[model samples]
Target: MSSIIPGTQNALTAWQPFNGARLSVTSKTSGVSSSLPNSLQVQIPKVVSGPIGFENTGYWGIKVQSGWTYQGSFYAKSTSFSESVVVSLKSTRGTVFASKAVMGISTSWTKFTFEFQPSASADTDENVFNVAVDGKAAAGQTIFFSMFSLFPPTFRGRENGMRIDLAEALAATQPSIWRFGISVATRWKWNETIGRLEDRPGRPNTDGLGLLEYLNWVEDLGAEPILGVWDGISTANYSDLSTWTVVPEADLQPYVDDVLNELEFIVGDAKTTEGGKLRASLGRTEPYALKYIEIGNEDQFQPESYAAYRWNAFVTAIGAKYPDFEFIATTLPSTALTPAYQRIDFHMYNSPSWFTANAFMFDDYPRNGTKWFIGEYAVTSTNDTNTLGDIPSGRLPYPTLQGSAAEAAFMTGMERNSDVVFASAYAPSFQHIRNYQWTPDIMTYDASRVVKSTSYYVQQLFSTNRGTHVLDTTPVSSNDTAPLFWVASYNNETDVVFLKVSNTGSQDLVANIFLGFTATDFATATAISTPALSPISGLFNVSNTLEEPELIIPVATSFALPFSDRFNYTFPATSVTVIALQSTTALEV
Candidate 1:
């Protein structure tokens, strides 16, 4: 696995008519045109001529850290005599950190370079880069600007890279598998996301998060990619039962070929396939960490018989081609006595109460059938009045502590039933603050900062402290029904016991934990807790001004060995706690 901290690289691109550039011409008569290829043309008809400025033109914002050097360059040409243009980096307050003047401009395209180091650090997204032409012009005088490039040190120091802060935040999650495909899977064509970044057509994804970039991110995070292939089914048509049908085999064959070719591009070697050669040409000689492929996003909408037909066709073709990889069916098999695929996908989105009550949902699932993948699950409670004002009044509630605690309880169930549940991932993993369509996402961010939801911390805690084997533990009292849930596991390699418990009630409860061994068998014990706040509805909601609090901090006096054979701990009301016991002996029972 790679280090959690990423290296450095350049974070800005698309300089010519910069991706999101805004033109500000002081003179109304002066016009700016981006119709030319790889360039922006500014025309001054001599009727009115003055400085023309462009700001906020990058893909997002130019993120600058304190005491870091940023290199900038641009190409410019003028039809008139020598001209001068000033370029500078400034904060939202109009404070120029650094500036430079390109003294001479010729008729021919010329390149100019400048370097600047911000004296102070900008931890926010209020920074921007600007290029301005400040002078009176004669008739027929025009200037052309192209290939404007500015680069700050990135997370790996690679050219055309990702933001360091956001990358680090994602890596910290320690995810086992990175599943890509939300609504994008319906119309996502793999060919459109490859090749040059500038050449890719503008679509709903304006942040430049293409296939290659996503694969690189997955590789950097030490996680395998689970690519979702489009099934040539539209979301609109899937909503109507009358239109529920599968595309003919002849029509679906070409799409299946596209998916297979994509897989070849991902896993094939340089000499084996054309897609592999293309992958090598893109600077990645080795195949990616690709193992699992999903047939479609959610095929549950189709009629069961038709859906089964689609699944069999996809499984037969893709499975025959890439037998080494595992395939996941969107739903259970409809025709086969045994499952046709390796795993079945299930999704759940409900209230907090539902998750807590269903903590043991998979306890009785047959151990012999197809494994299950909880591809999407979350506790979505619609009661947060804090951020409700920001959206429409009827919008759903934000993620709250009650929801997170319930999710914690649900995750403990998953850990206990890991044998049946092979893999799972929370849905809507990322949301850009400005362009988000989903509510209660795990990670929300602007250009400069990332806000981890309370649920995010819950996932981090469980992922980092996962165990190898589940240990049997006594069930909670049948008389007391205050929404208490628990799961116990032991790691033979580490010789440690992980006790995860969640209490979603009003009153504190004392839990008598039986280790089935003597207290002296363990050397030490540490506990961490996420406490629910008062009137629980007022739980902290992640937003712009403030992120989530330190809800997952360690608790010093939560657990104690009151007797030699038993451990006593007081679980706070409406809270989730994990107690890790370091043992000298690896107790099997």
Candidate 2:
């Protein structure tokens, strides 16, 4: 009795796992022999540099069922080099269900796979497979692998294997729209006595991925979800009891009252209609209406009178019981005594040309009216792993938990200054490439699977295309070129016109937009990508396993209704386009 498949084309035809597979192996190792298909040849490695050789441990199966979808591919070649390469799908008791990894330099044979859907604990048939090669493989480089088969679980534009309209049009972009939240106040904890996987649990203490599965994976990519909460600082150190610098402020108010009673059981577990229980209820006279709340993250290096007397007794007890909710204040080294602290969250690991050459560190911060939140930014020099395996507490050269592209153009100059910024999150969002400490994170999903980041499509094109009225134009070029544009003019009375464009320079940005008059046609034009001009070759390999997590997915392509009232449109450079124009005329260019 599993029904409920209404339209939108049956939710765009479910069933995914590399829709339409490909991967054949045995590229040539000259008379190679070990067994089954000559044990898949071997000898072309270098994925992060040195020590990684499955060389010939062959049998890389994939035929999945119980609702079908199995996509695995292979091709390898080398000349110059960089290092790192992995592929998996084991479960004949060998564990590992899905995996991915392929970093730096390639002389040819490029194509890797990891897409799944045999869930319910998979294994309907062909499954158990293995392939390893963790960096450095010269001595006559030559390797190849392949396997592909994406079929009906439902089938439409591609599910599980990805392309759900290009992951809702590249999530829609702004660093995947803020998703940094390390609950139980990350001083880092999760040993639950040999239970690994970040000590396995929920809300803060490191399961690392699960804040409602990161808001159902950023609301399944339509965008807008800047949420983070964890005022549970406990820095350890009962006299070097594994040193983290000891932050026992009288045991942090029962772990910030069990994180404010699990944020009041997730905003009073909203759900009601006769049977009751869904979760997210406000209006109970507003005790937890919260649009976003954060207050004890890096708690000023702890122990300062127990982190400023438990953040001034938790803003005098939840700001005298929810003052409409906005609260954010942690990671402050100097915001000048937190000015009665209402809003001020900063943590930039520097670089985007030092945030566009220190763009006034957020406009020469003065804070007369408060309001400023960056909440742990990243470019990575190493703060801890976010993605990229071998993390049994090793591996750190540049890991503010995985971030680069100049920290996604410093999150597009922090969304071109979202009007003095009020919310921004992107730290320790995810890390499970061998149990992280921080590497590269903007999105990482396991315990079910999920991944998105190029700064997560530039924060989902900036919170799903915002602009409810605020346009002053003026951008022919501020010394920028190649599709590097940024414009906003959202008027949602229903006439509809959400033109958010961000190219971030590289190429392909041929505009024409003159939304002054007569511009109807563009009912939708979503394009959240990964394989357009190679941004580290379409992501999704911070070593992802678990029955093939679509490596790094988010592809959405739709174009039909009217978009040529003399408005060419090309934009792709660094990608991020959300144009949903539906005008009937109403001024404001």
Candidates in order have lDDT scores of: 0.65, 0.46
Measured by lDDT, the strongest candidate is 1
The predictions' CA RMSDs to the true structure, in order, are 7.2, 23.7
List candidate 1 stretches off by more than 4 Å. 1-41, 44-50, 57-62, 69-85, 100-116, 122-124, 137-151, 181-186, 237-248, 303-309, 336-339, 382-397, 476-482, 519-560
Query: lDDT (0-100) at residue 269 of candidate 1?
Result: 89
My TM-score estimates for the predictions, one after another, are 0.81, 0.27
- Give me the displacement of residue 307 in model 2, in angstroms: 8.5
Tens digit of per-residue lDDT, candidate 2, span 294-368: 665555555364345666665556556546556666655443342265576777654334543343345345546
Looking at candidate 1, what is the lDDT of residue 105? 83
